[model samples]
Target: MGWTDGYIAVDWGTTNRRAYLIDGAGHCIDEFEDGMGILSVPDGGFPNAVSEIRQRLGDRPLLLAGMIGSNRGWHEAPYVPCPADIDDLVKGLVRAGDHEAIVPGVSFIGDGRADVMRGEEVQLLGAAAAGLLEPEALVCHPGTHNKWALLRQGRIHDFRTVMTGELFSLLKGHSILADLLQGEVEPNDTFKEAVRHSIAQQALPADLFAVRARVLLGQARKEDAASWTSGLLIGCDVHIGLARSSDPQVHVMGRPELTRLYATAIKEAGREAIELDGEQCFLAGIHEIARRIDG
Candidate 1:
């Protein structure tokens, strides 16, 4: 009665792809990773990539999520609107190829804007199924474009995106701050202090130039600028997300490093933060969908 009794789960994104093979007991028997992301696949190359993986893992049914379901992927799966649960996702699955299905992303229209998420919906569903998500919760998924979703009764109600990570990358790699943050600096009181300042001030554009100013004034070291900038951007994101929600608890889902930063920022904001493994939530979400379909 296990959900993934005869299927493999694929979380394909822009830069990397991960595949998990689950047995009848819902245990992952094998896993694979590669640089075969959407960006790496050329014209009509998805089938070849799938074939390569299938050759090694056997021709089990494929359940795909993430950018693989977008317009740039093998097949375009239309997004299902918010207030959706695992059942809605199961109903929205679109056929991509022989014995392969793509989970539809989720879309939300609120605050006079339209936002959509592809793979994170699966993670959210998985978190809900795993009993990690509370009945009413504010979930944060930190990445290039961090997502803050509102969950009510185990269904996604609304969400928003913050380009904090992408902005940090642009600043550290191409902007004026690049020279100051050319190297890494471990997080310290400086970083935490920056987070507190940014959250308290809520003035990012005005404060960003301070990274260079502090270095020029000998108030902060050039090496520490990276950590300071990271804290500022993440703090701004967390501040904004928390401001938008009345929920007192925050669920953070992402890599350990990123989640650690988010948890710190959330704590600085006087809210409780719970960390959840992104991979576990993603696989659980695929299984949740499959379970509903099988029933």
Candidate 2:
């Protein structure tokens, strides 16, 4: 999946987007990110949006990933089923024209359940294609909707989504404990303690109320509520993710700070944590796709 030719790769999401210009030397000659997400574009404005993006990056062939391929994006790139690889993604590419296309999302259905992911497929399969992941690895991508993907023989075998980040957002913004949980969530003793309680109990709804009650009862500081709530949610997340398989080491891919937090939570639950930069993985995945397309 190593690519040397030049191209423009866009990871378009809900609130922001980033575009990279890769050159013949395999270096990012130029790059920029802005708030031109799918939600920011006006009705029927995607054509203009694409122009704006290309103007910033280059006239190189456009390859868009993330939510830009969703039903709400420029074109609805259907999901490729699990046990997929880079070829599956390239085959699923929804082209608008020659050399202009949107990378599709990935879907998994089984055990009477269903799940889907858009921007993450690139990273998941990218990690594999770049040889950063093992054949029997359990990968964790933490975000608004955290994804835990099971890789079997270097293909995305199956995956599940956890809403821990969104839950924390709701709790910190709209929930009854909003005011109490406003402190910075450091990876301190409080966070680890909350994670342990959550993983052992695995009852997050019941655990969240403790954030308010503990503060009110003077048993815990309100300043610690944010960390506590984060731990509670992520603890439950790790608990369930680990239950899927006995994968002892969890490869967490994301921003350094966020990945560190998840790593702490994972380690607290008696598992190993390996952190990978999210942007690096994305670029690796994009390069893999670009190789398949331009080669």
Candidate 3:
């Protein structure tokens, strides 16, 4: 199929950026990725960056999501409050440079705290449109900052953010736990065991020291510490998400490896989990937005 008639959809985050050239039929024709995230862009350079990308991919209509729409991004797009649907998101789109637009993030204020998310809203919209999301569904988008969202009647009811991934990184790189971890950790029996432990105990700070003690006492290998730590954090995230949700089943969106880990943890908690491809959901959401804009 001729892909030259496609528009560009970009998922521009803090550390990296991904762009998809999608055809009129909503199929991705070409894709590109780069390390030039919002944080990397120099002041007043976003327009030039867009021009450079356009030169590589042609001057198609560009729609951006994620941190690229934040106050630190090319242009700040104010957040659309929660209980927002596809239509609300579509209406909230903010125009940028010529032929460019930024999707607004979603915000929730409740329980004496406020939460916000950007790129995941597109994924949620795609999931809802594809019939993958049920009424009153609990959707988990696992990443650096894991997002647990509640969807009611095709609208995002509320959500919570867990910095599990970020915390894991800090522990593995900066904390005393770093000394015990060796190499990349895979999701294995040790990981599962840690998940079960976290779920059962429901106390992370109290258990973290046990990891170090286990390694020092030769009860657990240093090589297994990373996986163990990963499991504990993920398990805690899932446990908290489930406890806050009234729904029994969860819809998880992420890469296969990450989602598998989350699914394993959810299953260990005796809850149901359905995995959805993150990229696909984002593309579908972009297509949906494009359609609504065109109409």
Candidate 4:
């Protein structure tokens, strides 16, 4: 069947994949998620994976996004350079087969830096399409490799990636503070205070060491170090993301758990934080792609 009437959309990533079925009416009828990401697919197993997805979801055509289009994934989809919109993404789609195609990622090169992203583009553009974001907005998509993007007139103008989450992991599991940075990072006073200190001090390794100093001085608890570190990392991230933009609000798009922490940091930085549902944004972006294909 032609994808114009109906299709399956897969927000396929590295370690996990989420799939949705859109009916002929353009409504998402059902969805499912699993650990069958690109990395899980054995070499040359993408075709089989596609077959299984079709069997499970429907016989409709497929529109895939995320790392599934990366070099190590099924097929390396081209990168649509900024500024790009949903239509640009559609135009850059790479066909792995007649029945299915992969959505391309976005690339930004400027200011003595180059940034690239795979899966977050769909949600970023989708947030605009879904009416959850302003025409001109600063979007923060939190993850192991967090993304900060500037949306200009519903297109991705430019973006940057901060490995805050990765840094947290490295510091927690391998660094000298490994034993202290344990437990889930929560949005509490300690965290917000650390965020404030981080912004005020603008000192890194210096501010980071405060966790130990506070503990040694009996001013903080071991269980709270994770929160403080999380705050510091996210605080620095928000500071960088908001440095040039005059926007007073930040759109935090991701899982609620991560978004909550980012929202706290954003507020501590004196900016309004608005949370956007990642799944809805992903579906909206996929639908926008479908609209272009059908047009």
Which candidate achieves the best TM-score against the true structure? 2
lDDT ranking of the models: 4, 2, 3, 1
Give each model a TM-score: 0.95, 0.97, 0.95, 0.95
- Candidate 3 versus the native: TM-score? 0.95
Show pairs that collide, candidate 3: none
Cα deviation of 247, candidate 2, in Å: 1.5
Candidate 3 shows a clash count of 0
Candidate 3, position 100, lDDT: 86
lDDT of each: 0.87, 0.88, 0.88, 0.90
Residue-by-residue lDDT tens digits, candidate 4, 41-160: 998999999889888987999999999999999999989999999889988999888878899999999999999999999999988988899889999999989999999998999999
Model 4 regions more than 4 Å off: none
Worst 10 residues of 1 by lDDT: 1-10
Residue-level lDDT tens digits of model 2 in 1-295: 2234578899999989999988765567889999988999999999899888778876778889999998888989999999798999999999876767899999999999899999999998888777788878999999999999999988899999999888989988998998987788898999999999998887889888877888889999878889988989999999888887898899999878889999999999889999998898998898888887766
Candidate 3: segments with Cα more than 4 A from true spot: 1-5
Q: Pick the candidate with the highest lDDT.
A: 4
The predictions' CA RMSDs to the true structure, in order, are 1.8, 2.0, 2.2, 1.5
Per-residue error at 184 for model 1, in Å? 3.1
Clashing pairs in 1: none
* lDDT of model 3, residue 190: 91
